[model samples]
Target: MQVMEPVQMALPVTLPDDETFASYFGGENSLEVSHLKSAFDSLATTFQYTYLCGLGDSGKSHLLYATCIHAQERGLSTMLLSMREVIDFGPMVLDGLDALDVLCIDDVHLVAGNDAWEKALFNFFNRFNEPGKCLVVTADLLPDMLNISLPDLESRLKWGTTFQIRSMSDDDKAEALVKRANMRGLELSDECARFLLTRLSRDMRALLDVLDKLDHASMAAQRKLTIPFIKSTLQL
Candidate 1:
């Protein structure tokens, strides 16, 4: 008789290198950050299942990516799935995910009104709840607030420790921008950071994107992150 080989599950997304806990500036969401950092530890028994919710660009997804990175660094099997991207592929995409040591689902609220996905997720949640397994989910709203059609799935989501990741203040955003720039080998003055915040969107993700563009443009022009250079390059 021929032996049947176990199927391998292909990850649908790649974890960004810069989204680790070290690169993240927790700001007002320090408690959420701390919980995620230790969620995968052998001694972190209470964090077996965790949920994070916050508005857009509030660093919820970043923390999820950071969690996956932390788990993989410890030689554990991990997977981070974005519900927004995988919802179109049907619920079969969730198959075999329970085998992972750490599983993170981002933007789970995207699956709120879908019956098939909801049922599949509920089943997946039960199977993934065994010993030594960690499941972390992120959504834009609390489980009770989400428009989840399945009552059981909604209740299961709330069963875990839920945290509301608060948005950072303007001062913290400026400091975080400066720190991120420093990480990229760029010298960004506090004044310049604040200038970008004022002239552009205050969202951290948007600010970081602008910073990335500035980084490349600055390197190419051998210029500093001056306001004039920013205006010329980004047409701000």
Candidate 2:
């Protein structure tokens, strides 16, 4: 008799090291942040599936990763998947994910209109109903707004608490930049942070990308972050 061997699997997405609750600047979305944090809190007597909706770069991905990180720190098996990255592999990539203690899928909206993907997600959603496990999903639109071909999948997405992370104001964006700079051990003063807000794209992702460049430039130049340094390094 021939026996089948075990199947080896790996999550196709990498959760960035910097994407943590401490490093995330909630800005005006503190209530949303609190809801996510509470969902992952171990002391809580119950676990709830969490769905986060927000425009691109509003930290939906950040919060998803943060939940995975929190679960891992508690010695739970975690998987982070991005539809944008793994959809090319087909819906089979989602197989066996229901066994994980925490399963986080980002850009779930990308699966919209794909019957195979939507059906797979709907089944996966049903399998995660076991106690002590969590499934966190994020999309750029509300569950009702997603173009999912499967009505059950759309309904499943809204089965749990949903939070919409609102866009940050200009002042909040400036403060967020400074907070992120501080997380990187850079001394970004209010004036410099405000200046960056004015000069860079308003999108948080773009601002963070510019910050990465500025962090490198500051290190290479052996200078503190200032308007002059930023102007010279970014040529803005």
Which predicted model would earn the best TM-score?
1
CA displacement after TM-score superposition, residue 133 of candidate 2 (Å): 1.1
Per-residue accuracy of model 2 over 22-107 as CA lDDT, tens digit each: 87778324776677667767433555788888885578877877777777777667777888889988999987777677778888
What's the CA RMSD for each of the models?
A: 4.0, 4.5
Summarize candidate 1's per-residue lDDT along 1-236 as a digit string, tens digits.
12223222233644335777777777425787677666665533543889999886678878877777777777667777888788899999998777777788889999988999999999998887776778889999999899999999998999888988777788878988898888888999999999998899998877878888899999999998898998999887
- Largest lDDT belongs to which candidate? 1
Q: What is the RMSD of candidate 1?
A: 4.0
- Candidate 2's C-alpha runs over 4 A off are 1-16, 27-29, 42-47
Cα lDDT for residue 46, model 1?
Answer: 41
